[model samples]
Every structure is written in C-alpha cells, then in structure tokens.
Target: MRIPLYALLLCSVPFMVHAQSETDSVHHSYTLSTVNYTIAGQRYQKNYTRSRELQQSTDRLLERIPGVTMIRRGNFAMEPTLRGLSAAQINMTIDGMQLFGACTDRMDPISSYVEPNNMERIQLGFSPNGEQHNASVGGGLNFSLKQAQTGAAKVWSGLAGAGYETNASATQTIAALQYSRSRFAISANGVWRRAGNYTAGKGQEINFSQYNKWNLGLSAVYLLKPNQQLRVDYLQDEGYNIGYPALTMDVSFAKAKIGSASYIYTPTGMKLKSWESKVYYNYIDHAMDDTKRPAWQVPIHMDMPGTSQTMGLYSRAKWYYTNHFLEAQFTAYSNRLHAEMTMYPKNAAEMFMLTLPDVQRTVYGIDLKDKIYLGQDWTLSPSLTVNYVQSDIYTELGKETLSSLFTGSLDRKNLIWNAGLNAEKHINGRWTLFGQLSRGARSASAQELYAFYLFNRMDNFDYIGNKDLKQETSVNASLGMSYHQHRLHIQPQLFVYRFSNYIVGQRKQGYSTMTIGASGVKQYVNIPDALLYGGELYATYRPWDKWYIQSTNSISIGQDNAGNALPLIPPFKSINRIEYTPSKYGFYAESISQSRQDRVSTAVYGERASAGFTIFNVGAGRNFAIGKNTLNVHAAVYNILDKQYYEHLDILKLYRPGRNLALNLSLTF
Candidate 1:
C-alpha cells in the first residue's frame, strides 16, 4: 500500500491535545467537536468519563449523557434510545465500522458486545437526518474505540477492576501491552467479565439471570515511512445468559467474530495540502437457541442460527485554504445475511427445519462537505450526500431454493440523499448561538425484506416481514443557546423531526388459519406520517474552586398522523450532581428523577405507563504514591434509595424485578 502525505498528519495528533482544543475554545462554531452538533444554536461541551474504574456498563453510562432518556439492557445486549429511538433505527458502530447483532432478539448489539473499558471516548451524534450513515432512520450515534497511547519508551500500562451491585455483580481483568519502534507499533488488549442477574429498584425478579463475556483485540501497524501505514485488528466477544426483556427466548450462547484491516496512504507531496485514502473489511458469525419457545407450541423454531458479513472501501480528501476547509468521502459496501429455524407440522407433531436462502445487498455513496470561518467568531458548515443501492434474495423450502432476481430492487433505484447546514454565531463573550437543519433518507434492510418468523426479542408477538417496503425519508431542524460566564455555564437545545413513509411495527389485518405457524404474524407497514420534537438542557456552576454543581434534563413529544402518542416515548428526566474535587481527592454525589408518563400508543399494548421515582449515587477516589509506584482507587454506590419502579421500555418489566445497589474499584499501572 502506498501511503499518502496527509495520512501522517491525522495519525500523528495526540488524543489529549485534541480534547483540550475542543473544550477550551468557546465559539459558536461546530468545528471544535468530532461528533456532537450545536442544536438550535447551542454548543454543548463534552466531557470524558473513564470506564476502566467504572462500575456500570456502557449502556447505563450512556443514560448519563445530556440527551439519552432510557436504556434497554439484556444479558449480551443493551439498547439506548435518545428521545425514544433505538435498535434498528440507530446506527451503532465500533471504530468507525458498522456491526450488527445476529439473534432476531438482538442479543448482541454492538454496544453490549464491546467492553466499556476498551473505549477511549464516546461521541453521541444525534443527527436525525442520518447524514453520517445510510441505515440510521431514527438517528446516528458514533462510538470511538480507544487507540493505544505510547508516548514514552517504557510506557508499561494495564488495569484490574471489579464491581458489585445488588442485582448486577461483575468482575473484570484487563491488560494493554504496547511496543512502538521508529516505524512499527503493536498494541493488544484482553479482558474477561462475569455478571449475575440484576434486580430492579422495587424488588422485581427480572428473569434469565447470569452472563459471562470475554474480549481480545490485537493491532499491528507498520509505518511505511512518513505518510503511509497498514493496520490490522482482530476483535472477538463470547458470552451467554437469560432474561432478555425484548425476547421470548433466552440466548444460551453467542459470539462475535470481527476482523478488520485498513491501509492508509498519504504522499508527502500530493496535489492538495493534505490527502489520505483508506480501505477496510468486516464480518460476523453467530448462533444461539431458546429453551422455552419450542415447548410453548409457538410457530417459531427453538434453535436459531444466523450470520452476516460486510466489506467496505472508504476514501476521503480534505483541502484547507486560508480560512476554509473542504472535505469529501466516497464509500462502497457489500453485505449478506442468513438465518434458519425449525417449525412443527400442524397435525403430525413432527418438527421440520427451514432456512431463509440468503439476502445480499450492495451500497455506494458519495459525500461532500465544507466548513468556513466566515469571521473570527462565526462558522458555517454545509454537507450533502447521494447514494445508490442494490439487493437480491433467495428462499429454500422444498429441496429447491426460491430465488428472485429483480432488475430494480425495493429502494435500490431511488436516490438516497442528504443535505444539511450548521452555523455558529457569537453573541458576546458570555453568550453564543448555534443551529442546524437537515433532510435525509434510509433504505430498508435485509431483515425487513426476508424475515419470516417472530422477532421475539422486540415483543412477544410474531412479526411478519415485508419485501415491498420503501425507503423512509425525514427532515429535522434544531436551535440552541449557551451562556458562559465566570461562574456559570448553561446549554439548551430544541429540535423537531418529521418522517415520511415511516416504517412502524403494529398489528396487521388478516388472521392465520393454521394455529401452528405463529399466534398471528404482525405485519411491517409504512405509516403515512410521524413526527417528533424534543429538547435538552444542561448546566454547571462553579461558585468555588473545589465545589461545583451540575444539572441536565431531556424531554420529547412524539405522535402519529392521527395525533395519537407514539410508543416508547421516554419520560422527562433530570439529574443534579454535587461534586468536590480537591488537590488530591475526588468525590461526587448525584440524584436523578424522572416524571411518570403513561402516554403509550403502540396498538399492541395500549396506554401502558411507568411510575416516577428517584435514585441517588455517590463516589470517591484518590491518587497517592506507594513507594516508587503510583496507586489509584475508587468506589461508587448506585440506587442508594432502592426505589421500586418499572421502566416503560424495559422488556423485563413484565417480570417486575426492581432496585439495585452496585460498587466498583480499579487500579492501573
């Protein structure tokens, strides 16, 4: 691989230095942050939370972000929704690459598959327009994997940690070994974890209670001198457990196989000031079973096996002028999926096996964007992308496969497009404003096209797939305002999103005569209209150097064309924190509360609501010298109040397990 000159500059910047610049500068500009956007005219500052010493999972920690409302946690998976959209609607990625869960129940979403300790930073890009990814119909989120840092020759580093909470108890061991030479670098991380079943605040016995997870990743980078490099990464996750809220079956076992290689090239002497190119590949294989579904006389298979693979070619170019920067990207991808199950014959009591032939798709896209500093205190950013996709499906039932080759795929020929504009303007030294507007579309997925059984994880009812579904289109607009003074900092954002041909899961018309296939399959249909509006407010005050107070709140409203409330809309939530950070010690305590909301309208389960409750958390940590070595330790308490309550989105709420206590400790050398 020939390395390009611009690649050297991007790979050379220090992570910590980039953070400092993003945090210290206070302009109405969106150029400072990597993934966060200024909403409705407000620039929100991002803070890094170290997970090595944290006692909770990444999905739980995501709830602490300014806009996250709730998290649906499972044994091997956790789905977090911002303002109320998750799972298939969200594009979850690891290290800039897309990863999909295998089980129909989504037992292994990318978030739960990757350990929190392994991540260096988490950036929540809530772009309702789906500008960053083609599949994010609801919104887009980006998770940045922590890269190895070997600034010093003898940078020996590793960490050991364990945590225990009333319902969730876990212990983990991890180590990072790195070797960097003048032209080559090697880094590896290995981790193992085990967790017991967790209960809710009021003593609910949520089900399938145990899980174990292990992950190992190795990276080798060969620097082909100045501007070129080749890197390879191997990451794997294996685990098993019970009581998934969204699924009818508990996953007995699951594993993720991921292998990626990227070659970057930058010529020291290129036509532009900086230019870089990259190529990458990814794949996943999964298998799991449900112990109770077969016994329940349902039409679904007791055992399921599924697999998918994706290959992508990515390239980007950037040109920096005196006061403006222009960048463009071109990407092409190919993916495929397969699933199988067993169903019993209606009258014979004999079971037969069935397999979905295979679903394959190819996608290509081009994006162009620009950022201009109109003035020292003002910034403008505009971006647009156009895409084309193609797909083919095959089904096998009676020894022979049923294959369909269509000249024009569902939405393959339709133009998937996006356009957005973001601007930041300074009001004064103490105030700033930022706003953005965008329009985007999402093409249908393989699951939506070929799935024939029930999505027991999303709901207990059977789900029928729709091969004729169309692409979903949406438009969003937001504005924000921020106040920054010597003693106070506050940021608030408000936004609205409108959808056309939105895909929604609701009960369909028609009944099945065969009592065995499934109770009745729920049809996937496109709703004529859907709309969502929301806002988030966050603030911090530092009356004293060592003592500070912070608060954050998020709220949203959603409805269908008929003015009926949408399902799973998270309630209004707020959290306040009081912290003391002295010269040598750190301590913090916080209380979180959410208002009760019974406004549900999924049609299947009508008008179900959750009760309001409050919980408290406290933590303390210190760093000191221990004979020639440094020592760090910390601990925290969760659900200090042990309040009993059920979450509206919790699939386990049907079992009523509530309240939990947890503590965590970590040490690094």
Candidate 2:
C-alpha cells in the first residue's frame, strides 16, 4: 500500500500541538496558536502585523490560509471559497455583521470593502459546533476590525507606509492615527491605491487590467464603568475605472458605506462572564458597462447597475457553570437588492430588463451551545441553531418579470435548523485527538431563486432562476490528530460532506440566448446527491535557534451521485518555506506548487483541464530604531522563474502576473 504524504511526514517527525477549549478566556487582539488545525475550536491568524503583510491587499493575505482559494476575475477584487464551496454555500461576515455584494457578476465581494490596515484578524469556524451564526454547511469566515485601544502608555501613536510594485506599476499609500486616554480612545485610517496594466509571463501586457481605489475608517470607544464600554465604527470604500480583462465589460465605479455601534459588559466573580450587543448597517452600489470595448468587439452596448442595503443586530452572552460553559445568541437582519440592465442595439430601439429584480429578505435566528468537561483530559461540546427566513418580490416590475417564467406565488418562507457535536481527548502533554459530526441546511439565495436573464461570463451562458427550488442540506464529519515534541509541530485533518438536493445550473436545450453571441440558456436545478472530501496537513520544524522550515499541503475531491466530477474543484497544492530570523532582521524563501488536474466537467460547467506549475519567491526585511520611533523596510521578488501558468480556478484561463519586485517602507511613532 502507498502511504499518503501527510502520513509519511507524521511518521518522520516528532511534533508538538496545542488546542483551545470554550473555558479559555478570549483575548483583546486574537492571535492564532502555534499549531493551526482544522479541528473544532481551532483558530488561525496571519502575521498581518508585519510590514510585508500590511502592504498587501486583503485578498492576497486571505490566500495564505490552509483551506482557502481565490477565484480571480481581475487584479482588483477576488472571491474566496472555503474547501471548494463558493457563493451562498458559505457565510462571510465583517465584525459579526451581515453584508452582501451589489454586483450581479460577483465582481465586488464583501472582502473588497475592507482594507488590510483596517483589519485586526480573521476568525474561521468549520465544524457545526464551531459556527452557530448562520445556516451553512461549508463553514464561516469573520473579518475582525481593528478597534481603538484604551490605557496605552503613549497618548498618541500611528504609522505611515508606502509601497510600489514593478509588474503592475502599482502605487500604494496608507496612514493611521490613534489617540488614547484612561476613559476614551479614537482611531482613524485611510488607504489609496492605483495601478496601470499588468504584464503576464513573457512580458505580455494584459489590457484592461488597471484599477484605482481608496478606503477610509474611523472608530471610537468610551469606558462607561470599570467593566462596561461603548464603541462605534464606520468605514467607506470606493473604486473607479476598474478593468476586468477576463469579462466583456468593465466596472465604472463600486462603492460601500458601513457603520456599527456596540455595548459590551464584563461581570467579575459571577456566572455571567460577558455580554455584548451590537447593531449595524451597510450600503453598496456598483455599475458596469461595455462601452470600453471596441465597436467590432461588442456588437451591442449595454449598461448594468446594481445596489444592496442591509441592517442587522445581534446580542450574545456567555456563562460559566459547574464543569460546564454555556453560551447563547440572538440575531436578526433585513436586506434589499436590485439590479437592472439596458442594451442598445445599433440603429435600433433600446431594450431593458430586470436582472436581479427588487428582492427583499429578512432573517431571525437563535443559537444555544454548551461545553461539558468529562474529567481533566476530555471535553464534549454540543450546539444547536434555529432560524426563520422570509423572502418576497417587493416590486411590481419584478413580479411581472418573473410571472412569465413561473405560475406560482411570489412569496417564499422557510424554517431551518442546524445542530452539531464535537469531542476532544488529550492523551498527554504533547498529543491530542479531535472529531466532529454535524448537519446543516440553507435556503436558496435571491440570485438563485429569482434572477432573470443573468449572463454568466464563465460558461458563456445566460441563466434564469427557479422560485420553487428546494433547500439544500448537508451532513459533515471530520477527524484530526496533533502532535508536538521539542522543536517540531504537525497537524493532519480529514473531512467529508454528503449533500442532498444539491444545486447546479443545467443547460436548457433549444432555448434562445439573451446576450449577443452567447451559448444557450441554463436554469438552476437540484440534483439528488453530491459528495465532497478533503484533507490538510501542516508541519513546522526548527532545525536551529534562528532557522525554521514549514510545509502546508491540501487536497480536495468532489463528485456527484453519478460519479461525475464537480465544477470549480481545486487540485492538490502545497506551499513550503524556509526562514532565518535574528532580533532585528529576517530573510525567507518560498515555493508554491500545484498538481495537474485532468478532471473536467465540460457538459454542465464548461471546465477544461489545467497543467501543473511551480513558482519561487524570496524576501528580506530589517527594522531600524531611532529614539522611541522605528522604521522598517521590506523587499521581495515574486515569480522568479517567470513561468506562464494559471490555476484551475482562474476563470477564462487568464495567465497570472509574471516576475516582479515589490518594496514597502513604514515608519511608526
């Protein structure tokens, strides 16, 4: 029998590991434990505090996680997928607030609204017991915002930074300032970025790849009492002249405004450990057009505009009992979305239609969880959530648009629930084992249930939604092991999911196309069953006091009940790195590799095979101290081999950026 790579590494190295339980106290600035695992209650944090990471985009920093992959349409905004699941299958949030994208083509994901400088850390929950905020089977990702800090030694502190990249001729400038006292704290930050067209491998300039954007954030906190505080936050982001070479149209502008307020209380020497209540609102606007394309390239010109607005609130409390920890939360939200398109044919009258129509959705949910201690070395956690959802077409034009396709009521409602159980056993001080089993279900999204004549650039097909589609559900199971010795740490995890009423877009034969020079139409449909399985392995070894080596590997497999490959599934990929660090300076070398994927879903998804490739990168950094202030400089060269390649998930098979040098400098006082 052939042994797996993870198993081989497990046998060859002695490891050390650590796990978190519900009883542990939460930190003000959450940081990942030394060992990062996919088990229940596992938290992972990137080194975003470093100067190198502070200069990168939010999307680029997210790609470093183990089970995450990015779907790129351009250099600007990229959508993220967790364990091969995208779109509505996963729940994404900012500071525990619900937000949705305005673009019908998914050019503006929620992550695009927050810059890296405004973020503190990211929290991920994969197990049903871990994620009780929403009805989702794939998992949940939450971006934590940076807040003002009180009781600091200095009355004021801030950082200023600038960066440049050769490949895209991109320039970036960022600034942050904070003021703190015994009872009050306030912070403000801003970022600006501009880029020209980028060059692909072999110095081929990729046209229509330029973009410009800016972001601003402000936060304030006031201490009402020794154990009580009030906080408020606001953020604004805007983008203009954004180009997408992979698609037929480019975005003229995209903008978002978000604001929130919260109250937090911590009780000492009581069963009620902590309580928090928060309310938030957000708005998004996006517009795109094909006027940038040449006359011959675009037989007809079209304009598309979309908007989304949301308001939400949540309250959570934690309590400690004898040998048990208990928690409960209540959440409610309302959202409205509208999208429309107008096409102008040469020497003909203008035609208009509702792409997404005017749709309204409201949701309310409650969650309860408990962690029981079964002695000193074992623990069990159980969680449950109940949610009520109501959806309707709120406009006469939307009702009229969908009336031609379906002969049913325009109102939809559903009650959904999710439950999960997890267990952990610690055999010794250095060895641990964990397992989880859970089931979850989610209602269809607005786009999936009521969209009309929505064109998909990936498959070159137009799509219509089905209002009568059934809810999708999944059953999940996972197991993991961790080991830690003196200088080595290793973790391996495996997971599998069985889905019911899986949703997909099926081709409708003999149907006319809506877009110019497009393929036939496709409609959303539910299949009987589908399966997804994946695994991840992480290892780090310290050969000497100043040198460290690390390896991360992940693989995913997806198939339908009929033994057909699923669309957009990524192949085996690995990242290896070596680093040497002394007190004030550091140097690193990294390699990223992916295996060739031959599995193609040509019939339904229009997928093609992709070849494997590898790339190398190197970087170094140094910090200089002058008085009480500090200055840092970092530089790196990426894609040193200049290989022409694209990942399996890259839509339209656009080649990634080629060799480039990046430099960043920052000063803190």
Candidate 3:
C-alpha cells in the first residue's frame, strides 16, 4: 500500500510544476450546482446557533438538506441517501480521503464517525461534473474538518456545551479548545451522548431504541514558510450497546480511528495557483449479537464481527490561465474487509461462516477538469476520471467457502471511467440556466460478490453472493433554472438516470437458508436495465426585516425493465420553515410532510405501501454576553402534535419519535 501510494505521489510531481506566469485575480465560477453548508462564521452562528443543531449529530443535520434523506433503523447511524441513491451508488469522503465502513449490515456509516462540533462545512454535489474524485452515479459528499484559526487577536479560545431531550431521556456533552500563534495553531474537541428507549406517538415505547457514543478529534497546522504549510488531523469515535429496533441484532461495540497528514503550497507569482497532497489511514471494528433479545424471540444465538482498514493518498493541483481554469488529481488506495458469523444451535456445535470474506481491494485513479469562459455569457466545464480496480479473496477458507457455490476463480478486476460536461448560460443577473450530462460505471462491492449468507432484516431473507456479476453503468442528464431577486430565490431541477446491468437481489429456489426462520434465500444478480428520475424545488423569501421563509419539495420515481417499481424509493416530501430574529433572540417554526406511497415492489423486494403524515416543530433561543465570555440558550418542541408516522424509505416501517422537548446551553470564551 505504501509503495503504490509513493509511486502515485512521484508520478504526480510533474503536474504540480508549470511555466511561471504573472498571477491574476482569481475568478470563482461554477457550471454545476452545489450546496455548501457553512459550519463556522456569521452564517452558521445566525442560523444554527439558535437551534438544537449545535447539539445534534452530523446525520441529523444532513436530514435538513434538500435532495437528501435518511434510512432510519434506529436512533443512531442512519444511512444517508443522495437523490434516492445510496450505498455503493454514491461516494462519501472526509477531507478528500476515502473511508469504508466495517459493518456488513451497514449499521455504521462514515458519517457516524464525525461529530458536528468538529466539522467546518459540508459540500454536496448533484452532478458527475462535481464528483471528480470518484466514478459515481448519484454524486459526492465531502465533510471538511475544522482547523485551528491562526492570527487571532486572542490566542486562546474554547467552548463547552450540554443538551437534554425529553422523549428519549437523552443527554449530550461537548467541549472544544484551540490555541493559535503567529505561525502555529492547534485544536481539540470531544463529544459524548447517551439515550434511553424512546416513546412513539400515543406514548408507546419502542423497544431497544437506545444508544451511547463518544467522539474525539485533534487538528494542528504549522507554517513551514510564508507559502508552505503542513497540517495533521486525527479522529476517534466509539459506540457501545447501540440498539436497532428494526433489525434482529444490536451492536455490542463499534469503533473507528482515522488520521491524515497534508502539505500545501501556494506560490506568489506563477500560473499554478495551489498544490495539495495528503496521506490518510483509517480502521474500523464492529461487533453485533442478539444477546439483548428475549429467549423466546431468539431462534438461535449468533455473534458477528467485522473489521475494515484502508490506506490511501492523493495529490491535487490547480492552475489558472487566460480564460481557463484547470485542475488535476491522482489518487490511490487499498482497503481490506473481513467479517464472520458464529451461530450456536440447540444440541449442535457452533456453525461458523465468513459473511464478508477476507477481501482485498486496490484502486488507482486520475481525474482532470477544465473550465472555459466562453464569451462572458456561457461557461463550459468538462471533466473525466478513470480508475483501475482489482479485488481478490485473500483467505483460503474464504475462497473454499465460495468455491462450493461458484465455479470459477474468485479474483475480479475492472476498468471504470466517468465523463461529464456541464454548461451554464447567464440570462441576466437574476436568472440562470444550467445543464449536465454524464456517463459513469462502478464495480460490485465485496458484499455483493462474496458474502456468505448475509441476513437482511428488511425482507427476512438470507442473501448469498454471486462472483460473476457484471459492472453497473449509467447515463445521467439534468437541467435546471435558478432565479434570484431582491427578497426571493427559487431553484427547480430535474434529473434522470438510465442504468444497464443493474444489480439487485433475486430469490433463489431450492436453496436452504442459513439463518433460522428466514423466509427464503436470495442471491445477487444483474438485471437488464433500470430507470430512475427525480426533481427538486427550493425557494427562500424574506417578507420583512429580520423575518425569513423557506420551502423545499422533492419527488423520485424508479422502475425496472419490466416496469416493476424499485424498492426503497422515497415519496413526495416537502419542508417549510419560517424564522424571525430580533437583536439577540431568534424564533422559528417548521413543517415537514410526505405524501402516501403505494408503489410497492411486493414480490421482488418485499416492500409495503406507506401512509402519508405531517409533523411540526418550533424553537426559540437567546444569546447573552458577560465580559469576554458569551452564553447561548435554546429550547425546541418537536412533533408538536405527537403524530405517529414513518417514512417510505424507513426500514420495516418503524414508527418515528413522539413529541419531545429539547434544551441546550453553551458557553464560549
């Protein structure tokens, strides 16, 4: 892994150097639409500082973004879907570093490893032109870590906060500290949270809806020279006794460690604007069991453990020229995953099998992007990425276990690539039109190719892997118009995806299930084709001074070649919010509603129709200053009507939380 990373780094050195040219003013223009959630500065303090967002998890914050939804199994680690696409379809990264989860059941997503307090901002891309780092169909999401601030008048700064919630009897605590010097800066932060079983609407307790977790982060930056800098970051996250009400088993423990080092160079008088290189490593360990279940409910005692490790590096450079902006990157990474299940049946020895076989995967990729300013009215941006992927089953036992079901070699390799073109026409200062077209491909994941009897609680079926599955490819296109005026802004966009060799689980007859009481057995297979289309509309208006109103609406539709609806597609959803701020105090009201979803893939995916529901929330907050210190207090009431509801994408149609009152307090100096 180290050797390959070094080789890539050496190969990227030439791209960082160019003929020197006089520096000019930088022009920041984008052809593709992007949403940036700022976590620092005045915008963050004005919006999120007055609400429960300061105390909420990263996943909770993500739910508020348009075109993004969560698949909730429990209160912790909800999986995020971008434009109705999830898992291997989208790419998620932290600070440009690739990370993979260790849980075979996807109980721990990458978002769960970072606390909101340690983040600077979140960048969301909705087009392939924006996802230049990876070949993905849905898009890309990057979580930028907060770095220590240097050159502040005050050399030291810190904050401490705490929060409480009524429905789940949950408590949260957080603290952060930073020190800055003329050329050096360092920051540290930590967060801890604990929650008990939560009650649904009508005061009905939801069993096993509890969790406990803690996260710690450290970051440092040093200036080697006026134009050179070095930065380092480390993060540690751990969770214990996390309950999942919709799944058969609960997580006993899950932990992750991530670290990265980076170097950045900015020259004063050259065409090369900046160059950045980074090396990163991460490891995760997860274990789950049914020990918390009642004896009558447990048909068999089982324990599952999984581990994943990754090491990677990337070099990126940006160059500016007359009427053109160019960017290039080289990335390489190696990842290993291993998972096993041990089942104990009555009057029999324990049966053991590899769920996610010991699999090693390596990838090398290059990306190039260029933006051209055409005649001041139109902007054209084109990008291309190519990746070489190789995967193999390492352990002989894993190979032999798959040999019983498959008849060929267990090694697989593929060359994947993505190309995209974006165009933007500025009709006027208040109106703009943008469009994107892209084609992308991705290889199958380890679980989709080599897993042994992985149980899916959603359909109550045991899933087997197929080693001969073909790569999935898609052609995507989108068009949108943005309108902005004095007090009102609205944007509406529509997108479509046509996929070939779509991968899905198909029921297999005459195959016995390894999980006790499973409905049947299913295997991963490739279908001929599939289609997915969606649209979103976002609007914001300011009626008067210190008052604002916002609305967002989204809808998605999906079908297979046979015209059968795809499973897990979300229904039409809408969110509306109103806010008022006066001096040091703020108040807000929000409404969230979803339409009924009757499109069920009953026979193939075991999906059921979901009913429509609506919910409301209100919050108020105030800020106080004393000497050099500041204090903030906030209170919110969620599900004001105590309505019982579940989203269409929720697993098992689990009921959401009931009415709850939350209080938060924070102190900064």
Candidate 4:
C-alpha cells in the first residue's frame, strides 16, 4: 500500500499501486487507488510519526490500503494478505530483490524487516499477472529505500527522532544523516526499538509479545556522466526475543543482511530513453524455541533453526518513439534453504535429529510491454512474460527414513507464461474509465514440495510437503472508474478470478506426524477449479476549508467448484473518517466495522467460523519551532471505547488490543 504526502495534514487519500513513465519528458506523482485523484480535486499526503519504530508491524501500514489486510497473531511479524491470498501466493521484494522467510512456523514475514524510516516509496500491484515481479495469485509488493537527495550545490541535512507508547511500554529512537555535493551523495540511517507485554481491553496481560529490534542502512550514488549514474545500498535488520502466542514457539533471534548495486542510463534526443542493470545479495538466519516463553510442564527441550540465501541479477530498458512506448526486463535469481531441528528429553534417552535436505530453486524470466496512445483520450497497454523455474534437492537421504515416507523425486521443473492487457479512456475531464484482463501462473514453492512434519498450532495439524504438486494458474479481470470534480472524489472497482490447480493443504491418514494437538497430518496438494469475486467503493467529500469526510467499503467471496466456501476469505467491511486540519495542527476521528463471516470452509482441515467487530480511533498532530530546529509532535488513541473483538484473519482469533495512547516527536536540523 502506498500513500502520498507532501505538506497537507488533512484530506482523504487512498493507498495505491504506482505506475510511472521512463521518459525524461514525463513526470507522474500520483498513485492508482480506490479513489482516483483528479486535476480539479484536492490531494493529501499521509504522515506517520515515529516511522523507525513502526508502533505495530508493517501490517499496520498495509491495512490502511483498500484490498489489503494482515494476519495478526502476535505484536510482531504480522503477515500481510491481499484479497484472501498470502505467503507464497504473493511476490515480496525490497528494491526489486526477492527475500524469502526462513521460518516454517512463519515467525518472520518479508514485510517485518523494512519500516517506514527506511522506505522512500512502495510500488504495489494488485493484479496477479506478474506485471512487476512474477506470477502470483494475490499481488506483488516492492519496497524502495530512501536515497541521498541530489542537487548542484553542496548541502548537509539530518534528523533526530524519539517516541514512546503507553499501552506496551514501547520505546523508539532513530537518526539519519546525508551529504550531497555536485554529482556525488552519501546517506545513512539507524533505528532501535524495544517493547514489553501489552494489556488487552480488559487489562488482560498477554504473554509472548515482547521484543527488541535493530536496523541500519546506508546508500551512495555517483553520476558517471550527464545521463549515466551508479548507485549502491546496504541494510541490516535484527530481532531478539520476539514472541508469537499463536504459534508453539517464540523466535529467539533473527537477522538479515541485504546489499545491492545498480547502474542506470537515461539518454535524451535518442530512440532509447532509459536503461538499468542491477545485482543483489540477501541472507537471513532465524532460530526459534520454547525457551524464550513461559516454561512448559513437558519434559522435552526442542529447538529449530533455519537459513535462506538469495542472489540475483535484474536488467530492464525502455524506449519511446512518437506515440508508442516499449519496455523489456530480464532476470535470473537463485534461492538456497537449509533447516534442522534438535530435541533433548528430561530422561536423556534416545535423542535424535532430523534435518531437511538442502533445497535450491533457480528461475529465469523475460517480460515485454508496449503502450500505444490513440488520439488524445485513449491509451492501450499490453504485456507478456515467460518464466522457467527449476528446484533441485541436494543430499537427498538415499534409502534413509526420508525416502520411505515421501514419494516422487526431489527434482522439479516448470515452464510458465503470463499475459496482461489494459485499456484506459477519459470520457471527459472529470470522469475516467479503465479495464484490465490477465492470466497468471505460479509454481509450487520449495518448502511446499519438501518440508517434513512442520507443526502448525493454528489448525492442530502437522504439515508434510509433496513433491508431486502441480502448478497454480489464475484468470483475472477487473473494471474501475473515477468521478473526480470540485471537492468530491469517488472511485469504484469490481473484479473476478477463476483458478486451475489451486494449491492447498489436504488431510491425509496413515502418515508420519508430529504427536501434538489432534496429531492430524496433512500434505500440500493441488485442487482444481476455484472462483473468487469482489468489489470496492471509496468516496471523499471536502465541504469546507480544513474539513473532510471519507468512507470506504469492500467485500469478497471465494469458493471451489463444489460450492464449498474457501478458507481465509475476508468479510464485508467499511471504514469511515472525519478530519479537521488547520495550518500547524490537525485532528481526526475514524471508525471501522466488519460484518460477521459465517461462510466458513470445512473442506479445510479444521476451519472455523468468525464473528464480527467494530473499532474506533482518534488522532492529532502539530508542528512547532524550538530554537533553530523544527519539531513535529503526534499523538493517537486506539480502541477508544475499549471494545473487545477479534478479526477473522487473526491466526488465533486473539482479542484485539484495548484502548491505547501513543506519542511521537521528531526534530530536524
């Protein structure tokens, strides 16, 4: 989800997927959102105080966008979901580099590592047609980090910030510095965060929610010539003592290091307009155990550790001639993963270790796009992508216990292609129409094909991966329109999707299983023929100066060909907002309501129905000057009425947080 913020403190704006041109003669700053922006309407930018600490996880940011939601289990690492799809169903990236999570229990989601402080902008694509990343059923997210500002004159700039929250006793500190001169610039930023257990609305103390985190980043850019540039970036993220009450274990520690370098050239007075080449490396190490949580009465001492490494290269170029624009991209990436589990019994007898064989996946892809302008009010854009993916297992336990339980070879390969076509037209200056159609495909993930007996407490099921799973393909379509004029902005969209070979976990008997919960075992398998449909509506009205009213509503339904509802589908929901803004300060009130979800899918191993809930929130912020420095102060209250409710998407349906107060302060020099 992406929001625009420049200087305004009030006015309603939607989070969006970004689309921009490659030509130097074109400049676009707005995003594609639920409520489209118009030349005659007002635009507002969003601001988050204490961005470095990220009061909650990144889920809090994505939730504000239409068609986006999160799966909350604990206070940390809330998993993001889009239109009822999550995990491997979506493409997750940072600065165009893919990063896979290392936890079988999902203690770490890709979004947990990057906070607003390190983010300059986000390019979000809700389409499942590999428009930006690769084939996916839900969508794609790309987080671009902040770069050193450039200018002709030498300059120095920096910021210092600190914040505290009352409910959880959370504290945040952050600092950043930058220097630019002529064609060269360098910048760096660091952040630290710590928190204790938080209380529910009824003052119920929740365990396993405390955590500490550290983040650091640096970047440098140099101009090679008038239209050529070189850039480098590095970031490190660390977490200690993170907790997850919904899962059986807590994360003792997790760390990630990411590095990238790119060269860009944009030429004028030529047929070719822009070209870019980039290479990157990322590594993640994660360890989890029950030692960090309250000691269980059981006698077994168990620990699990996992690691993932990724290396990739990406190249793209765009060309412009008359009314036609063309762009092409090529990429090659490889991912390696290793995991092992250890156990020690109080009786100190017959302790054993089972390690997953090494897993490696390599992918090569190419994409081409063409945009043609017809007359002045109509535009047509078409794109196509082809991918070849292969995964090979190394050190396959030859004739060992692993070979007896799982069937099929560990080597898998698939060739896939995706296509998309979009059309847009301006009926008049105040109204515009757009439509899109696409077909996309995604292959089974390595973990889905090879992980052994991973514990899942949510459904009380032990999961085993099958190497024979097939690919997933989706046919998708959507139509959207906008009414923008004067002080009102309204945008509405409708969409539908049909899938073949949908991947899901299936209950199976007579399989080696973990002796916990119901002890039921399952395998990742492919289901045929599934359908999903949905729509969203958003509107904002500004009747007077410094005041606005905004409202949004959305709903989606999913089911298999047998008419059985699918699991993890979101319910009908709406969000309403009222804001008042004046020069140095602003105030707002918000309410979110969700209808009960009764259409549960029993086809899922242990699915359950979900209840409805409503929440209220209020916030305000101000800017002031102290000596020669400028300072901004912000404060907010959540769950103002202290209502106890839970979202259906929550992994454990845990009660949501109670009434809470938060304060943030930032100083600039």
Instruction: Identify the leading candidate in terms of lDDT.
Output: 2
> How close is every model to the real structure, measured as TM-score?
0.86, 0.94, 0.93, 0.92
lDDT of 4 by residue, 473-496 (tens): 889888888777777878788888
User: Of the pair 1 and 3, which is ahead by TM-score?
Assistant: 3
Worst 10 residues of 2 by lDDT: 3-12
Candidate 3's clash total is 0
Off by over 4 Å in 3: 1-52
Q: What range of 10 consecutive residues in model 3 has the weakest lDDT sum? A: 7-16
Q: Please give the TM-score that candidate 1 achieves against the real structure.
A: 0.86
Residue 565, model 2, lDDT: 89
Report the candidate with higher TM-score, 3 versus 4: 3
**What tens digits encode model 3's per-residue C-alpha lDDT throughout 1-669?**
333452000000001101111111011111011223211100111223412344677776677677778899988899988778888888888888888999988999888988777776566666654542677767777777878776767799888999999999999999989999989999999999999999998998999989999999999999998789999999999999999999989999999999999999999899999999999999999999889999988888999999999999999999889988999999999898999999899999998988888988889999988888888678787889899988898779888888878987889999999898877777877777877788888889888988889988888899998889998988988887777777776778888989999999999999998877899999999999999998988776779968877787888899999999988888899988887877777788888999999987888898899999999898888878878887888888889999999988889999999999988888988
Q: Which regions of candidate 1 are displaced past 4 Å?
A: 1-55, 70-76, 128-131, 150-155, 166-168, 202-204, 265-276, 292-301, 344-357, 394-412, 456-459, 513-519, 602-607, 652-663
lDDT of 1 by residue, 1-669 (tens): 111210000110111001122211111111112323333233333332233233345555565666665545454466677678666666766666656666565666677666555555554556643333453545555555555433436545555556555566656566666776666777777677786766655665545556777777777778776676777777777776544544555666667766666666666544454444445555565665555434553444456677766666667777777777877777777666677765444466655333444666677778787777887678887878787777665333411332221223333345678787777777788787877787867776666655555444334456655667788777878888778776687878888889888776666567452224344556577889889898888776878967767777888888887788887788788888887777656777888888888777645534466787677777776666666444555666666676675566666444333444445555554
* TM-score of candidate 3 relative to the true fold: 0.93
Full-model lDDT for every candidate: 0.60, 0.80, 0.80, 0.73
